[model samples]
Target: MKVLVTGAAGFIGFYVSKVLLEKGHEVVGLDNVNDYYTADLKYDRLNELGISKKEAEIFKRKSVSSKYSSFAFIRMDLEDRTHLPSLFENESFDAVCNLAAQAGVRYSLENPEAYVDSNMVGFLNILECCRNHKIKHLVYASSSSVYGLNEKIPFSAEDNVDHPISLYAATKKSNELMAHTYSHLFQLPTTGLRFFTVYGPWGRPDMAMFLFTDAIVNNRPIKVFNYGNMERDFTYIDDITEGVVRVIEKPINDRLNEKEYYKLYNIGNNNSVKLSDFINEIENNLEKKAEKQMLPIQPGDVERTWADVNGLIRDYGYSPDTPIKEGVKNFIDWYRSYYKI
Candidate 1:
């Protein structure tokens, strides 16, 4: 299978591409290499995949590694509406995993336009390209934040997600709606995965796990939002990559006689962990006490997030097996090795 993976330089994208290559699938990686957090980290991820910075900067196609001859990388952005169309027309991708978007919920509050451009407009472009190119399947990254303030214990794909608290969540919800439209109108098979608090090694720097780990290792104070009352279904990256591969392997097929081919699922750890407990695990792994600064929750921040992955398990056998302690230990190990902490 020839797979087009957007945001290939990102944490999840890098992991996903690596797994796909391991499965002997041809993967074409696309990313703008934006400096949202740190482009160096992005490049380092690409470097792990055997793409050099010099070659990546030259705007020419590059191979993944010496062994993975089927893998390639391209320097492209989703917002490049003109060139993006050409890419699909040329590559004729068998399927697309759309993970490129303005990621941070808090960052959305600061830069609303970025969200509009990447999450909304850019996603629209992907839908258009998928529809026009007649791609077999399209799997996109949605968010658990879409279930804003729903008071639901474990968020389900069937839950009402119309009322989103943050602009980022609203955009993710809007993406589901747009995807349904394309699926209904053009018979495009689409699946949206509403990811929970995804955390692990090579994770985003803006996320809590990375931030807290950096702060603790550097003796900086870690801010406990919502007075440490928050709870999250912190998911490991390996589990997420597994779920994604399963979905990619089994494309939804509701077109023959069914009314709709669009579907959504929550990809997350079924168990929710308290914020303080997560911090404790990190502290325990690092063998360092964290200097805590309790503060009110910032805007666009949710009090809690949990995922009901029953549907995922039933459909794709997606079960998160990594415990929080083990996940934290892996992340701490990576942090220590990456930063020599």
Candidate 2:
């Protein structure tokens, strides 16, 4: 199958593209390569996928990966409706994994319009493209943050996610709603994966794991949010890639009803780890104790997040089993190697 992976420069998307290429699928990677965090890291991710920083720097031009002949990449944004449709028509993608978006919950508080443009309008373009071109499957990334203020221990797809604490979560929830509409109206097979706190090697720098590790390595104080009372279902990157690939392979193909065409699953470790325990594991890996700055929870932040991944387990016959200790060690090894710390 030929797959178009949006946000191919992203952490999850890069891993997913690598796996897909290894499985003998043709891949066309796409990303705007925005400096939301840093374009350098994004380019480095692309570099790992065999896309040269030089090739990826040229906007809207397709570059074939030297490392993997089956892989190709184009630097572009999702909301570029004119060019996006052209790419869809030209590539004739078998499936699309939409990981591209204005990520970071806290950043949304600062720039809410970015979320609306990328998550909402950009997603609409994807839905339209899939519906118009008759794509087989669409597996898009959702988030555990959508369960904001729900008080639900293990966030389930069946539970209500109407109250998203951050604009980022709201956009993700809105994507699910838009997907449902597309599936209902056009019978487009769409699968939404509500990802838990995804952290592993080559992870996002803005996330807790990276921030804490960076701070500790630099001998700076790490902020212990909510006074060390937070918990997260930190799913490793490889596990997430596995689940996403399975969903991509087995899209909601049955045409029983509109609901049948649209599916949602929580891809997570299914085990919540306390914030302090997580920090301790990182400290263990780095062999350095972090200076802690105790602070209250920031706005647009949840106290805890636990994903109920029974649906993922039942359908995909897989679960995220990587222990926190193992995941942290792997990340630290990669972090130290990448940064030469």
Per-residue alpha-carbon lDDT of model 2 for 247-302, expressed as tens digits? 88764644235457888999999888999999999999888999999999999999
Name the runs in model 1 displaced over 4 angstroms. Answer: 59-67, 254-258
What's the true lDDT of residue 194 in model 2?
A: 95
Clashing pairs in 1: none
Cα-based lDDT for every prediction: 0.89, 0.92
TM-score of the candidate numbered 1? 0.97
Q: Evaluated with TM-score, which candidate comes out highest?
A: 2
Give the per-residue Cα lDDT of candidate 2 at 207.
96
Q: Lowest-scoring 10 consecutive residues by lDDT in candidate 1?
A: 58-67
- TM for every model, in the order presented, reads 0.97, 0.98
Clashes of 2: 0
Q: In model 1, how large is the Cα lDDT of residue 55?
A: 58
Candidate 2: minimum summed lDDT over ten consecutive residues — where?
A: 250-259
